[model samples]
Target chain A: MSSHAGSVQAGQIQRHKLVDRLYHWVMAVCILTLLATSLLPIIGWKFAWLAIHWVTGLVLTVAVLFHIVRALFFQKPMSMVVDGQDLQNLGSGGRPGKYNLAQKLYHLAIAVLILSGIASGLVMLRKIDTPWWRRDPYWFSDSSWGVIYSAHDFVAMSLVTMIIIHVYFALRPDEWHLTRSMFRGWITPKEYKDHFDPKRWNAEEEA
Target chain B: MIVKDIMAPFELYQPAQLKDAFSLLDSFGKDAWKMAGGYDSLDWFKDRIVRPQAVIDLTGIAEMKGIKETPDGVEIGALTTLSEIENNPIIKAKYRLLADAVSHVASPQIRNHGTIGGNASQNARCLYFRYGLPCYRAGGNTCFADTPEGINREHALFGADRCVAVTSSDGAPALTALDAKFVLQSSSGQRVIGAEEFFVGPNVDILHLTAAKPEEILTTIRLPSAWAGKNFYFEKVADRNVWDFPLVNVAAAISVQNGAIRESRIVVGGVSAVPHRLTQVEGIIQGKALEEGTATLAGQSSTRDARPLNYNGFKIPLMASLVTRAVRNATA
Candidate 1:
């Protein structure tokens, strides 16, 4: 049931822009494809997964770089910050602004994991033949390489866990509107009033 | 360039005598790995992390294989399995802290297969070091665990020079607390050193964890009667009860007279490259009554010099609490 009495109408508030939506979906697809290509081979599947894995890794890395630049230069960075008030609100179940504490934490965790994966993945690319360079395993000592591999492997597994939790939350019945906003780039005005604090998060400012 | 996870073929020598083992070591030089229990050696071989030309099996040396009661104390051979020391009646009676500490190592399976000497001489347990990462302990120029984002929750909080890997042996601190002496033998001669002095820190030598030379072998561990029958306390806090090394382990043998401590030997492991003896804490607690105030004070002052790494700052508090607990347990 809609709680708002007047002024704001339904389906008029923008939650995400078109470029942000495209970036989100593109990154999601790349992550899923990377996971499949990297993990399927580990589980005894027979296929040429290396080339696909590396190529998709490069794409994901580029997408992450693009997102970082876009968020820093074009977006209001403080909107996503989980400050002291956000943490206090998390305990009290107070109304969130643009993102809740849990959402911010998930985003931060995903960002860390992906950045670590990209760094280690880039180092690992030196070990395999690519269009740009020949395979050079001796760039680092065995032990140094071991650290890279361990970091890369750790990030991969952590992303799997984070994504599982993410997808599970996205598929919930009540949270479907938020998920739909990622695709349609907007939410109903009723959802804006229902889920967010207008004082903390101004829709006009976001627009 | 090297493909790991496959054991390369190497020559094996089972020397029945100490002299023969020394000869094999001399012949192989630095290319030989002294195999006592094959606990640490096997993993290195399996991973191709260490490829020795010859493996000098000290298991064949009969003289280095049992526990015997000496006139002043007890002498435990270097090749004695952890399980043997854990189950020995004499060790349990006289130096129960050693037995208790040995019991906390890895698991029953590892205890059965692992020897006390091997445990004492084991390498750094840092994942980077173990995986043959080019860390300072592995003859590299840098310590991988010293980085801002390094996975070093199990690293050292004290005496970390260029290497942050900790001393992982559970038996070392116990022996140090008991004021034991390590008997080392080589082709040239035999020498005895204090148990506390046996372990070398990263500052002294990052390449080797012990004072024993490449030619020498740890022949015996002498537990003197000084701290043997004292009020003993040993505790190991690990990630798991069954199969894990300690995050911080404490061993204390305190001599109390009229509820006041006459003397105490306290050693902490897993917080440094060697078993760190808290001489300052010992001094502070001497002649003081073993009470809550003294224990708490001892705990508070224990971490005065601890310099924890990026992910191991928790170890400072953990080590301090353990020392406090050990002092309190001694009162109990």
Candidate 2:
């Protein structure tokens, strides 16, 4: 990966690339939209929410697919994987490579929920009419449809809880730098030195 | 995603005589929807989930409209509203458990419109099935609530065939505890079944929740003298005080003789497709007094065979607690 000399200032570390940041924000918007449109109706607020909810679900599914491909092939996937060493660090308090144990676990958990949600949502799409095709409610039997709906609803509820915890941590004063890095695409040299071990995370190298 | 808010037009047949209703059902067969109070049937119609060719209105039948006092016990008309059953002076005095359980169903308005027959014959209340998903109960092969990641906080912990949906009626367990018998009539003849056998699980028949065939109509519910005026306890726990189905409801009747329990029948609802009769727990506390120690043991024994789903593990504990409370209240 070629580091853009013009974009990188002196004494700074690139935590996220421009494309990755765009993907993150786009995914965030889609998830928020999905949650709001799906949950608001259960609490007495009524509108044409089903259409918006399904559309946003499709958008999120596409974004997640892209992120999976990029993270697997173009990025350093090993850095995010939690191993026995990470568990040892819980007691030893050793600095994590790129992500702490909690961060890695949260990422893995969210990934499972999102993928399940997308898969279940795709099965449900057949039950509704779309611009491209007529509705086929019999694509799956009643029992199969029940399983699909249960998974989708369960994933949505879990995401609501996980997202709340994620936002709470992101807004914390101590984690402000990390949240800022998500938006600005870079972290100060001081933040890099203070948070990560240089040997584990070499900022000069490709992701 | 398709919001089916209105029902498709159908022929509505108001039959004043039972013979006319049976003939209509016989001709229409499965295409006929027998409606009592329309509390459960209306939802199915409004959602367009089950579109029938004919709707048979049973409200006009005069023979199935009153509670009659029999020499053995009492026979309640199947079409009696929940409010009518709960407010009946004879039922409140002799069979208070049934009265108490019926009163806890939905709200006053719903009880006013919901009939005992409809409540017993109501469909499973699983969100997936109610939302018109092709679930096991809906003639599909999969059981969503049994999955590792499925939302099953309000699902079954026992007697789950392919579907984990629980029995939604509060009156079912109460009637079961009271050893009630249901009188059903079809075109050919009339048949009687015990309350325990009135309900069918997914294992017995995946498509239907009750034993009543499409042509058969539940005419009367007979409460035998066996359980009348026995020490009774009834409790229902729900998400809302009114207008909500029970998360778990229990009904218990025990006869006490000289500070010792003579016999008891305990049934728990909303934990299985059928009202789960706690026979083992009943055996455990057969000759024992209704004390804390016996109640605790009975409670622990009630959930011994419970196989809870992922999100419904809490139901095991909740059911146990309710059983314990029911046992203690047998004497109170």
Candidate 3:
């Protein structure tokens, strides 16, 4: 049996090279680790997880900042944003994009969650005279970091929800290859043609 | 690393010429499948449902490319990407319905890669096939969709017998309604099948939906110039606004004379195994002023043949409503 059934032309597009794949997987692990650590405090797990959470949060904050800077400086920003063609597809009923409809939505959601988590974590730190982090010790007696803590929990919950959906879809058999595509870098030529460029084969045939 | 282990084994053949490609298809037959944009094909292959021995890559062939305006009609090479078609000025002005249909296929990236031929030849996006389950359509012993009750909503309203997968391709209905011809090439020779006859029914073979033989390649699509003056429209309803296939879609091309319907063609996709051409409904509207009563009657006639599935009974009324809306829009 041939694997190319239902695919368009033969040559595959190298979406993510080996270096990109390593970066993506490493980033996934770091994000997951951060989520787990942050969730402990919100769901009332033992406070020990708080120590681990803070450590991972610090690591994740640095990593995210690095990623943002790298993407801005090295990667093409146009690829991430919804383009004119994307709007056309949304209007018609076409396939979304490389990241696709769900992926794009999730990307934005996670970015917001990460930013909120870091911002709130920074504010909760005592001796930091940041504008939003300012807290009068007497106002909230039991919890000096009440507002910051609550904001952190809320963003954490939202991040968890988004991650759950993302993982669920990723693990689903129908979408298994889509998740795998990140790791493999090279999808089957068939997949590259259908999902990426129909004309790839067309020009080949003509030549 | 884990993903590479699961990758299926296959040989890729890139034929730099249409003649060479046709010869390959002739030799390989069903064992060799053609790859277009890889959008639909790759997804199906990944699911392990469709496995061909060799993929005949048409991308390298020069003869299979290009979109040009001939004196007779517009010649759209089968490999013309949806994005190209959407941006083509001649197509935009002459056959807006074709442009409209291509515009709604998947996403910008998908449009960039997906070809018109691939879209037209795409298989039914049935739940059973998509989920990797064996059903009657896939040559299994049982019809999972059929039960003690006998008929289901997803079953074909017109030509279904054993299987009831909907024709999920968006381009067919619009092109069919606009009166297009598909130019097919094979090692034996070349032939043209009207867009209407391109899709076969269960009556021919319950397992297959298209009339094209495995050895045959769809080369070019030819659309009549007469359709230029006709008003065209396509509408689809889905679960959400983005990334969902149509629950039901309607495409209409009509010519009105003196405030009455002169000639009209209406087709519905996502509701049946093939583009269900509403000839009876078209007949009803001919020479009549397309008013609310006429539109409602036309809509009622459209679904007279529908054989709704267990989960898709809503399609009957939904199809009726769509036809009504299409008629109203064409007239207005």
Candidate 4:
């Protein structure tokens, strides 16, 4: 039983507990669904996946908002944000994080896609006689809907490309378990250490 | 439960004293592995390449942590995080080049947690072996890297034989160029190994890279003060601008006397199993004027002895270009 359970240190901080894992997976499914639905219109599958897209988009929007609230107020946010140290690491040619280089880029790409999707959705809504928020006179007028629509289309294309890369990289056998980190919440201490601590790992043999 | 069914079931041993740590290590022998930040170790464990029965956690040991400045040089603790080293006022003021190298290690979260000892001792970033294939590094019969038709882009440019995995640490070349020394501690006593001899060739022992005994711990890294006045620069060419491993990197430290290269140490990273010191190139550039043609010739000379694998032929030119750039940057 001791061998099976693995030894746990007394004061070690649980980076990801059961609840965190559940929320992450739930968010992943919702975001992926939203990404697919949002992309269909630009790729000419809009009519075919419209109902599903609309449903998923609405649910994702609500879910993302909820997640943001939870992260900001209810739960501690994961420290994936780019910091001064990260910028330094980037310059050094070392990918130091649970997320790594690709993952950090993926996060930024996703953030841009989400923001663009929301803005575009609001603009397109005006066509259906529903206005979420009227564009301020200082920002843009009805005549600039073409510009907004085109910008949205560009962002949608970028989102598709990012998704393709994301899926392709994720499916590679070496990286498949990275997805499992979201599901399992707790990475094997080995994974945490290797993907994170080169110094510790290197010096350990001597210890 | 079956061994295959166990997720991350490994024992954790935290010895309070260095002697105690060595005793536990000696008892368990090869079955015991040390844990620091667990970065590279955890990944290997996940791949099932390193399944140690006992893990000796080094985090709890006080002797192996912190950074100290001595009149001779800087003595960096094994467990000192890259962030700590990068942001250390002494390191930044005295060893700007080293600080610059550590700064580029990874992301902020990783730098905050990863130690210098771990960075220097990290394993090869060979794509094939990392994916859990029975490559030569895993003591398999055949060498996957040298197959008749395969992707050998990331293979070694030097020390190529049955295996060609390149040394994948960024800090190594920088440290080597600065002439760093590593202090190792075991039950017997203390010993110092030059950073240059730390990495073992793939043909030697596929399992371990350094010559450190199992019971020993890398306790300190000493960088001499003589390396301070020289201008140092690290340049790497990679696939992307941000957060990507270098295809080839050059760490060059040079002392210029009136427009002439008085002395220089050129160390090339990401191209071989160890940070390759360019003695031939340094010899050529010694007392020579730093001109464009000379720089180009120096670059060519540096890469003259390169023994690249099938797919990594581009690295020869890429490394040369990086060397040229590093020379220009250091001289400037």
Score candidate 3 by DockQ.
0.00
Where does the lowest 10-residue lDDT sum fall in candidate 3 chain A? A198-207
For residues A43-105, could you state the per-residue lDDT of candidate 1 as single tens digits? 534344667788999999899999999999999778787888898886788888988888988
Fnat scores for every prediction = 0.00, 0.00, 0.00, 0.00
- Candidate 2 lDDT over residue span A1-207, tens digit each: 445642456666889888888999999999999888877755534444667888998999889989989999999888889988888878998877777788999999998998999899888876554668644555776667778888988999999999999999999999987898788778898888888877778888853
> Tens digit of lDDT per residue, candidate 4, span B247-310?
7878888888788888888988787777888988899888998677768888878778777666
Instruction: Say which prediction, candidate 2 or candidate 3, comes out ahead on lDDT.
Output: 2
Chain A accuracy as TM-score for every candidate: 0.93, 0.94, 0.73, 0.66
Q: Compute the lDDT of residue B31 as modeled in candidate 3.
A: 87
Q: After superposing the true interface residues, what Cα RMSD does each candidate give? A: 16.4, 12.8, 31.3, 28.6
Which digits, one per residue and each the tens of the lDDT, describe model 3 over residues A1-207? 234533223465546555556666776787777677655533433223434555666777777787788768876554567667667777886654455655666777778887988887765543222235432233333344556667877887787778789889989987766766666655666665566544322323322
Better of 2 and 3 by TM-score: 2
DockQ of prediction 4: 0.01
User: For residues B50-79, what per-residue lDDT tens digits would candidate 1 score against the true structure?
Assistant: 999998889989999999998979999999
Residues B104-166 of candidate 3: C-alpha lDDT, one tens digit per residue: 776778888889988888877766655665565675433445443444444455555455677
lDDT against true structure, model 1: 0.86
Give, for candidate 1 chain B, the lowest lDDT window spanning 10 residues: B140-149
